[model samples]
Target: MPAQSWKLISHFWGLKAPHFESQFVIVASSFSSFLYLGACYGYFAKRERNKIGKIQS
Candidate 1:
């Protein structure tokens, strides 16, 4: 019985996996880009703050 269920599950995935994979790729790339941009912004902002502090002292 378990084997039969596993076969059914695999068959369903075989039909649908490509569509889900494409969606996952699109989502993952967008997420990574956002993460990279946020890191760059934070780094630049910290550097700018340090420069301001130096000018004040």
Candidate 2:
């Protein structure tokens, strides 16, 4: 927040700066899940690609 904005808010309610520990955990978890899902998708897609257009004898 800008200095002026914080000063104005301070007149009524005090606003403290955010700590990064919890935010980092949330972000890390989100990225990890996304990467895991993407890897799973790629693995399955590659495995199915070879058989997708082939005729089964």
Clashing pairs in 1: none
For residues 1-57, what per-residue lDDT tens digits would candidate 1 score against the true structure?
234554565556657788776566556555666788889999999999999999999
Question: Lowest-scoring 10 consecutive residues by lDDT in candidate 2?
Answer: 9-18
Residue lDDT tens for model 2, 1-57: 244543454432323434554455445555666788889999999878857757463
Error of 1 at 47 (Å): 0.4
Candidate with the greatest TM-score versus the true structure: 1
* Clash pairs (backbone) in predicted model 2: none
In model 2, which regions exceed 4 Å deviation? 1-18
Clash number for each model: 0, 0
Evaluate all candidate structures by whole-model CA lDDT and list the values in order: 0.70, 0.58
- The TM-score values for the models, in the order shown, are 0.65, 0.57
